[model samples]
Every structure is written in C-alpha cells, then in structure tokens.
Target: MHSLNVALGARSYPIIIGSRLLGDAQYLLPSIRGRQVCVVTNETVAPLYLARLLDGLPGFDKVDVVELPDGESYKTLNTVNRIFDVLLEKRHNRTTTLIALGGGVVGDMCGFAAACYQRGVDFIQVPTTLLALVDSSVGGKTGVNHPLGKNMIGAFYQPRLVLADTDTLATLPDREFSAGVAEVIKYGLICDAPFFHWLEANMDALLQRDAAILAYAVDRCCRDKAAVVASDERESGRRAILNFGHTFGHAIETVQGYGVWLHGEAVAAGMVLALELSLLCGSINNNLLERLRSLLRKARLPQRPPAEMTVVDFLQAMELDKKVVNGRLRLVVLKSLGEARVADDTPREKVIEALKNCGVR
Candidate 1:
C-alpha cells in the first residue's frame, strides 16, 4: 500500500491507496475513542463491497450502516439529514466516527453529516470510484448539492483517514472508470508535467487495469494532492490551482442537471475549454492545446461541451458555480501542461467566444 499524509497539524491524517486496502481495517481504522461507527454508502456499492468492509471492522462492537439512493441527484441536504436521523436514532454523539464507504457522493454527504452531527465528529473515507480516490477523498472539501448549484451547501471537513481500495474498482462500469481518469488527468495538468507524460504513455494500461500502473497512478495522484493540501488546506490561495477545469465543468454539470454529464466527463470538456482560453490569451501555444485535446480524446472523454447547451444557459449555470467571487467568474486556467493560474479577470466576451468555439452553442 502507498500512504500519503495530509498534514493539518493536530488534525493530520493518512490516505492509503492500493489493492485490498479495505480488507486491512486494523491498519486503516485507528483507535478514535468511540464505540459507535456509521458507514454511509449508496445502493449500487452497498451490495458489492459493504460486506467486505463489515468483515474488516469486526473489532467495533456497534456498527450502523446507512444505504442511500445512488446518484448525484441524491446528494442534498435531505440526504445529509437522513444521516443525522440515523445517528439520532442510534444516539450517536460527538465521539462517533462516520465512515464514507462509497464514491464521491457518499464521501461528501457522509463527511458533511459528520461535520454537522453534534457540531462535529470524525470521519473516514473509503472511496470506491476512481474520481473519488483521486480528488474528492483527498481534500477537506465536503458538502451536499443545492438546486441552485452543485456543492453549494457544504463544509471544509477533512476526513480522519482515507482508504482507497483498487480492488473495489474492479466492478466499476467502463464509463465510470473513464470519469475517474478525467480527475486523475487533472492532477497531472495542474502540477506535474512528468506525471502527465506518464499518463500519456500508460493510458491504455490504466484502462485495462494493469495493477502496477493503476497503483502508481493512484499513489502519485494522492501524493501530489497531499502536498497541495498541506500547502494550502483551505483553498485560500495556492490550492485553487486544483480547480484547473472545475469552473466550466461545474457549469456544464449544473446546466445539464446534476447527473446528466458525469463530473469527469464535464471536466474533460471543461479542460478543453480552459485550454482554448489559455491559447487565446497567449498563455499556452496552439500545439499544446491540440496535445491536451488529443490526450482527452485518447481517454474517450469529451473535448467539447454537449451540443444542446446554449451560451446563455451556460453563463446562467456558471453564475451558480462556487468559483464566482464577488460577482466575478474565477477560473483555473492552464499556462502550460504543468502550470495553472486562477484568473478572475478573464474577459467575459472571450469566455463566450471560447464556449462558442468549443461547440457549446
């Protein structure tokens, strides 16, 4: 197993990534001074790996499992409230530890529930999806989606531990697996060019589930994310680089409805848009833009936004994105393959043109 630490001083924790990590709970779940434990998961993942997780938690005398409806649409305040309802029924207190046992939706909701339950409680992340393992499970960012926006209602509650089991991914559908790759590629685009090159070479191997390559990718992604989080835990400044394509991606997801375009698919297209904008602004050359697009295309990810979305609709949806600060639309744009910058000063007209140029209507 490859382990990376998110150092938050007293709240520091470890993220373990590898095959069969879930079955090794004695090493994964440390003593947290609590008898009550709640494992939150979705319908799809509950049947597949929940039992394996339960077997690993044999030492815990009391364990409660909450199975939520599976989908991005269910990530809401109501779902989080349901978690509270379960905890309340069980009389769980501040000392209880909540284990997020599924993908991004489960991790975000469970983490937020832990944050609000009796003020606060510890939580662990056992992310099943590739997207969650590479991105959501690492950062302290946690929340539920709103009708107005995705992740609009949330908290910055960090997990006590993050256990990513590569074995769990064996059952993931092909589209879902590709979605996860989008986020994995994001880590490379934002901070490490060498990793990006590695991804270029091993794309096929990763898709085919080559254990060594997947392990290396997961470990490297986690290490890079941990380093970024350690430097800027709260996204006050430097950490915003992680948002590389998220501003546009969130808009696509919101406009199309939460689950219409998987987050990674939207990000795949959004990265294309960001790259176009970068080229237009003279930050990255046209050749680099084509290379980036080619990489996304090679992964079977979208290079353009959905044909149905209009420019006006996209702008309206973008307004709801969390990146909007003081009415200014802020975006993380790539200067080149290994560099990114958060620009709130990007011209609105240029953004509209780029949207049009990318066939976003």
Candidate 2:
C-alpha cells in the first residue's frame, strides 16, 4: 500500500491506495474514533462488496448499512434523508462515523450526511469507482446537487481517511471506466503536462486495465488534488482552477437533466468547449486543442456537448454556477497546457461565440 497526507494541519488525513483493501480492518479500524458505524452504499454495489466491508468491522458496538438507490438522479436531499432516518432510529450519537462505500454519488451523499448529522461527525471515504477515487473522494467538497446546479448545495467537510482499493474497479462497466478517464485527463490539461503526454502514449494500457498504470494515475491525481485542497480548502482562490471545464460541464449536466450524461462524460465534452474558448482567446493554438480531442476520443468519452442543448440553455444553467461572484461569471481558462487561471473578464459574447463554434447552436 502507498500512503500520502493531505497536509491540512489539524484536518490532515491519509489516503491509502492499493489492491484488495476493502476487507482489511488494519486500514479501516485506526480511522474510526467511535464505536458506532454506518456504511452508506448503493443497491448495485451492496450485492458485490458490502459483505466484504461488513466483515471487516467485526467488533463495533453498533453497525448498520444504508443501501441507497444507485444513479446520479438519486443524489439529492431526499435520498440523504434516508440515512438520517436510519441513524436517528438506531440512536447513533455524535461520535458515530459514516463510511462511504460506493462511487461518487454514494461518497458525496454520505459525506454530506456526516457533515449535517449531529452538526458534524467523522467519516471515511472508500471510493469504489475511478471517478470518486481520483476526484471527489480526495477533496473535502461534499454535498448533493440542487435542481438548479450540480453540487451547488454541498459543504466542505473533509474525510477522516480515504481508503481507495483499486480492486473494486474490477467490476466497473466499460462506459463508467471511460468516464473516469475524463477526470484523469483533466489533471494533465490543467496542471500536469507531463502526465498528459504520458497519458497520450499510455492510454491504451490504461484502457486494458493495466494495474500498475491505473494505480499510478490514481495516485498522481490524488496528490495533485490534495495540494490544491490544502491550499484553498473552501475554493476562495486558486482552488477554482480545479473546475477547469466544470463551468460548462455543470451546465450540460443541468440542461440534459441529471443522469442523462455521466458527470465525467459531460466534463469531457465541456473541456472541448473550454479548449475552444481558450483557442479563440489566443491562449492555446489548434495543435493543443486537437491533441486533447484525440486523447478524449481514444478514451471513448464525448467530444461535443449533447445535440439537443442550446446556447441559451447553457447560459441559463451556468449563471447558477458557484464561481459566479458579484454577478460576474468566472471561468477557469487554460493559459497553456500545464497552466490555468480564472478569468472573470471573459466577455459574454465570447462565451456565446465559443458555444456556437463548438456546435451548441
């Protein structure tokens, strides 16, 4: 197992990445400070790995499992309430810990529950999907999606530990696996140029599920994200760069309706638009844009926004993005392949032009 710390001082936590870690108490037991535990997962994952996880927490005074319905559409306050009902009925107190045991949707909701329940409580992240392990699980950003926006209603609650067992990914569907690759590609586009170039040459090995390459990619992303989170835990400054393609991506998610396009898939298409905007802004050339598109295509992710979406649809949804400060839209644009900066000065017309150029009509 390989371990790294987020370096948040008092809130610092370790992230452990390895194979077959789910059923190991040695890794999980040390993180839990309380005797009561709740394992939050989804119906799809419960059948496959829930028993293995439950087997590890043998001596807890109280242990419970909340199997949520699986899907992006189910990530909401209503679904989170189910966890509250169980915790309350079982008399779990403030010291109880929440163990998120599934994908991004499960991790987000469980983390949010731990943050809200009893004001606050400890929680651990055991991200099963590649998307969660590389992005959502490491960052302390936890919340459910609002009808108006994606993750607009969440909080910044760090986990006590993030235990990512690459073994869980064995059962991930091909489409879902491809979706995860989109975020992995994002790290290279925003900050890690060499990793991007490495991905260009090694994407085939990654697609084949080469264990070493996948673990390296996951570790690299986690380290990249951990540094950002430690510097700007609440996204008050440079942390916004992490949302490189997310402004346009979140717009696609809201317009297409949640679950229609997977978050990573939408972000893949959104990155294309962001790249086009960067090209028009004179920060990047056609060569860089094409290189990213080629990589995305090889990953089996979408290279364009959904056909039914319109320029107006995108604008309306984007206006609700959290980055909008003082009514001005702030977008993370690429200054170069390995550098990005937030630009509030981007003209509304320029955004529309980029949208039109990218087939948003």
List the lowest-lDDT window of 10 residues for candidate 1. Answer: 24-33
Best by TM-score: 2
Q: Write the per-residue lDDT of candidate 2 for residues 202-231, one digit (tens) a residue.
A: 999998889999999999999989988898
Global CA lDDT computed for model 2: 0.93
User: CA lDDT of each candidate?
Assistant: 0.87, 0.93
State, as a TM-score between 0 and 1, how close model 1 is to the true structure: 0.98
lDDT of 1: 0.87
Candidate 2 positional error at 71, Å: 0.5
lDDT of 1 by residue, 236-269 (tens): 8989998887888888888888899999999999
Worst 10 residues of 2 by lDDT: 146-155
TM-score of each: 0.98, 0.99
